[model samples]
Target chain A: MAKVATRVSYGEALVKYGVPNENVVVLDADLSKSTKTDTFKKVCPERFINMGIAEADMMCVAAGLATCGKIAFASTFAMFAAGRAFEQIRNSIGYPGLNVKIGATHAGISVGEDGASHQCLEDIALMRTIPGMVIINPADDREAQLAVKAAIEHQGPVYMRFGRLAVDDLYDDDYKFELGKGVMLRDGKDATIVATGLLVQEALKAAKILEDEGISARVINIHTIKPLDEEIITAAAKETGAIVTAEEHYIMGGLGSAVAEVVCKNAPCPVKIIGTEEFGQSGKPAELFEAYGLTAENIVKNVKEAIKLKK
Target chain B: MDAKRITELSIIANKVRKDALTGVYSAAAGHPGGSLSIADLLTYLYFEEMNIDPKNPTMEDRDRLVLSKGHTAPALYGVLAERGFFDPAEMKNLRKFGSFLQGHPVLGKIPGVDMSTGSLGQGVCVAGGMALAAKLDNKSYRVYSILGDGELEEGQVWEQAMFAPHYKLDNMTIFVDNNGLQIDGDITKVMNPTPIDKKFEAFGWHVIVIDAHNYNEIESAINEAKATKGKPTAVIMKSVKGKNVSFMENNPAWHGSAPNEEQYNQAISELDEIIKGLEAQL
Candidate 1:
């Protein structure tokens, strides 16, 4: 299978679908090349604004453009976009409910070599606290393109998370992407594996490993974490009775916390979460994933524990 | 501008000051000093300048203004009400629960507000974005913003100061209300953002200094800003902390404190006398 970074897909989609509408404008804080927003700038230089290494200014600028009927996409590293400029996003964009899309790339522990400062494990938590912010963590290349399209089509504030590392393509061309809806990949009766971002492929691999051990594990990809698909999560909990969640973020407030909130409210099930609990270190991407326990093996181990807890 | 027009604007400005004091007195907790400082400027923009319609506040090609120093929203609200953007009666409901007159300027709630702004340093950048939007769309409408002197302490303001000129946002003009006082004390005593004109000039803006209360100087500076090309203009207006109202003028205590009943009455009466004198001039 071909592997592509979600940031690459997002950049391609912005040029193909976003700028063609003429109302869509792109803003980057001098990280255009890394965030892949340079692709949009290459094609539409007039509509692209290089805000020059100021995250707070870029977010506010995007908010200002939104007020004037422009769909502005502000791109930067997740650490800066969500962590550094959190208040600007909350006050200027979220409070007013403006049509500003935050393209936060290089999220999570996958941002190896640069270590803890560059890897943003708290972006989901920071953005989730805002009143009307819609958070989408795409799983693969196809889903990333679709998430960008959905964000541009949506009428309010949207935060789209992308990855620095490439992962295998999990979906084909015919897949449909909808806001606030989860996609069920493989269904089973024993347990459910809920995942998001780069960990969705890990969840699928974990499901395969569990099946080899005679454990029928269901798989679900929850892209939207804010308006979480409680209906689907609740149904999965009721049918499977056990749930394991995987993500490339902190266990405290990422996909794990979101799924736990839904499961605890609607259906009482034993849910095990596979995510980092500490800051990541500088290493290879694979080594960082292993060190943080964000791998298919960890998801498989958690699934067994959840199944035992259910019994 | 002629004497008659200046007198008419002076009358309107006096009314705006009264309305701003009304909201502050009603709230019992709002920025009165800064609000009073910007009353004349607001009156001039909403009445004599900007091509805006009260009936259609969101009309395309309308010039937009962002109150970067948004704690002074009472003045903006008062000027908008005087311009017939909404009922003047709403001034009393400022900062009350469920009222459209919030403590700071909100965009959709108020008819004439171009952007929601309360956070210092953010509004100026947003105004730059609006100016960039006008250039991208090839529209003739210009963008305007007002900032407090102490607000220059915020680093985001410098970021925008660098941004507006780099992009050559010639369609934007910003006013720095150099009242010289902040919540702590005099701006120089607190944290010197002095040499403000020099800083803007260094940042590549067309810098112009004028007396904020002088209508002739204000109008001329605005004309200079519009005529200048290729760079944004910064009009540094030297002003009194509290322009009118005898006791509040240059008083740091009134920076964010509302007046008591007696103080409120005194302020309103002083403004009323000014309004009467301006009306007689007409």
Candidate 2:
């Protein structure tokens, strides 16, 4: 009778983790409130640094703090954090393999209203290409919390992608998330739908619709894009024979590219990728999703197409 | 430590310049102009000034040095090797495959190298970060970073300039090798970074302009930087692009180009005579 909400926004999860980890320091480049680092600032004013609008300087400062045994999380819009601070991350953090977490919010077309310039679609590709950088795109608030905690625990540089919009909370409070491990939400052998970030919920919904038609669909939430769970993905590909990947990013080097890399190397299976092929346009979140073909319906269509290729 | 000792260090810098030329000539490709320009400062820091032990390169309390203009690796490599951080014979492996002496400085590969820096403006920020870390940890270790004048064009350099003062990284000493020439041409024509002293002051740093090749001035600046409190110090060392080599001085072509055998011989002769003159004075 009522539409269900599945997850929390990335901002809420950041606050939950920041309150407990005293060693966790948050830095924002003048967008403290927008990036959700303001919550940490409220509780630990001394630990939070508003580094004006200098993202490059902020990244180096975070790397410095991390080198001194402090777990540092630098928060900024995806555009600034991934785009402006790329060199700093490459040399100072990635080169030395320092433990620094970059929380890049307002990723993809879901950043809506800000138009194309503000939204970042190629961040995952840029971050994942760097050696020793762990890329994580959490699906919702529960996963975002887990991702933040996991990033702190994981050594070396990590880039965590989150969205500006709030989504459904899929995980219960007691659920635990492991780095580089994919979670299978539904079990089926007919077709496999692998997805990440905000698209995981859509894949789950698509699985439900596929079941109504007497098709048993398997849905996996791939949170860790880099150091991908090859064993699990290869197993799923071998068992299902058909696979579809969806993400709120470009198909070139996002989750789809990662899945394709695994499938091409070890498990060759019929695969379909649903994501942005070109730059997103100025529109609402729903309009952008439909325009980019990142909807649950599109996932279902792509999954069926992949199933046809399997035969 | 004193005027006479600084003069002695200057003579040692000339020897370092000779070593740099030989190393680069052997490699057949390296930046010699900037390397010679920053030799005196590097020599004084490694030999006379900084409280460092080559045997314990990773000692937590030892002062840290970062060669931000890493293309001048020849100068740093020459000084570090001369200081016994590693075998002096290993200097021959510059830029060779699997050599610890990479085109740029890499940590752990070379002893006495505090950080790996090659991508221009990024190293200044890293050095600033290290200085900030020392302050946060309440360590007395200071950081010295040498940047090329041409690298001042990168915006990140200015970004670090704005941050260093806010945090009062007084223990950090930055040296700008104002060698006039970058890769293309003179820095003045390429990108004007005039009034450099005032710029550092504007960003809350204590500024000092000195003759870069002058051993006395360099040593004084180092002493002043260590004495000053509450703000980082930037020593704007006015230097010739190629200091000792007459034909290559102020020439941009020699920035990253190796000399012909004849030219290398000529450069060595001039350096050897200078070293002899200093020895005669002693």
Q: Individual DockQ of the candidates?
A: 0.81, 0.50
Q: What is the C-alpha lDDT of each candidate?
A: 0.93, 0.84
Compose the digit string of candidate 2's lDDT tens values, residues A1-311: 22221123445555676657766777788887778777677777777767778888788778766755667788888889888788888887888787789989888888888888987988988898889999988886677878887887787889988888777678887878999999998888988999998898899989988888888889999999998999888988999998899988888888888898999999899889888888777889889998889899998888888988996
CAPRI docking class of candidate 1: high
lDDT score at residue B20, model 2, on the 0-100 scale: 86
**What lDDT is reached at residue B11 by model 2?**
84
Query: Which ranges of candidate 2 are over 4 A from the true structure?
Result: A1-23, A67-69
- The docking quality of candidate 2, as DockQ, is 0.50
RMSD of each: 1.1, 2.4
True contacts kept of each: 0.73, 0.38
- Candidate 1, residues A160-239, lDDT tens digits: the string is 99999998999989999999999999998999999998888888988999899999999999999989999999999999
TM-score of 1: 0.99
Name the docking class for model 2. medium
TM-score, one value per model: 0.99, 0.95
- Note the residue pairs that clash in candidate 2: A6-A168, A6-A169, A7-A168, A7-A169
Candidate 1: global Cα-lDDT? Answer: 0.93
